[model samples]
Target: DGRCLKDIHCLELAEFRWTLKQAFGSSQPSARYGHTAAVWPPESEIPGRDKDSEFLFVFGGHSAVSELNDFFAFHIESSTWVKVDTGRQTSGPSKRFAHKWDWSGLKT
Candidate 1:
């Protein structure tokens, strides 16, 4: 469900199609019925550097419980995924499914 703000419609059908294509490939049904699943709390509100440059990241959701120590950044300009590895074995919050993260900029 998309919320329209101040008479502004926020959902783009074409982008949705593109996203689905990226996730599932070709919009074709999978032979394995449960291969694709929805992520609960479907929104990740990472702040953008500007209108043209932004980072989009996603994590495992309810259907997938694996703790994701690995992440990838999507450079909109290049339209590619850059794998990010946090070499430091720092301990903090455990990786959780259905989690949303906002960019905190670079960590010192």
Candidate 2:
């Protein structure tokens, strides 16, 4: 099939294993490819959550029809996905795919 997928998987560094993630949040990114994703707020704790919990931020990818610039964040601990709004006040990047997100200074 040439369809995109919304499934997620995780790798455990300690155990050197890969596991498929299941039963995640209802809201999620559409099946896409060539998107940029990274563990955001690096080495920081999320408020109201465990110190180990982190968020995965995804941006810009391609679906079957076109490029996407939508943003989303996934809570690792709760298996939840939340769409992020890049407000109108600021002009964000155009829709694209196969792009790089540099976290060094949080530049896209």
Work out the TM-score per prediction: 0.40, 0.80
Worst 10 contiguous positions by lDDT, candidate 1: 27-36
Question: For candidate 2, lDDT tens digit of each residue in 1-108?
Answer: 667777788998899999887636666899999899988666533446553567889998999999998999998877789888769425898899999987554353
User: Which regions of candidate 1 deviate over 4 angstroms?
Assistant: 1-52, 60-65, 90-92, 103-108
Scored by TM-score, the top model is: 2
- Over the full model, what C-alpha lDDT does candidate 2 score relative to the true structure? 0.81
Provide backbone clash counts, one per model.
0, 0
How well does candidate 1 match the true structure in TM-score terms? 0.40
Q: Model 1 over residues 1-108: C-alpha lDDT tens digits?
A: 322111111235667633321322222221211121222122443343353454444332222323434444444433444554556547634545445555443541
Pairs with steric clashes in candidate 1: none
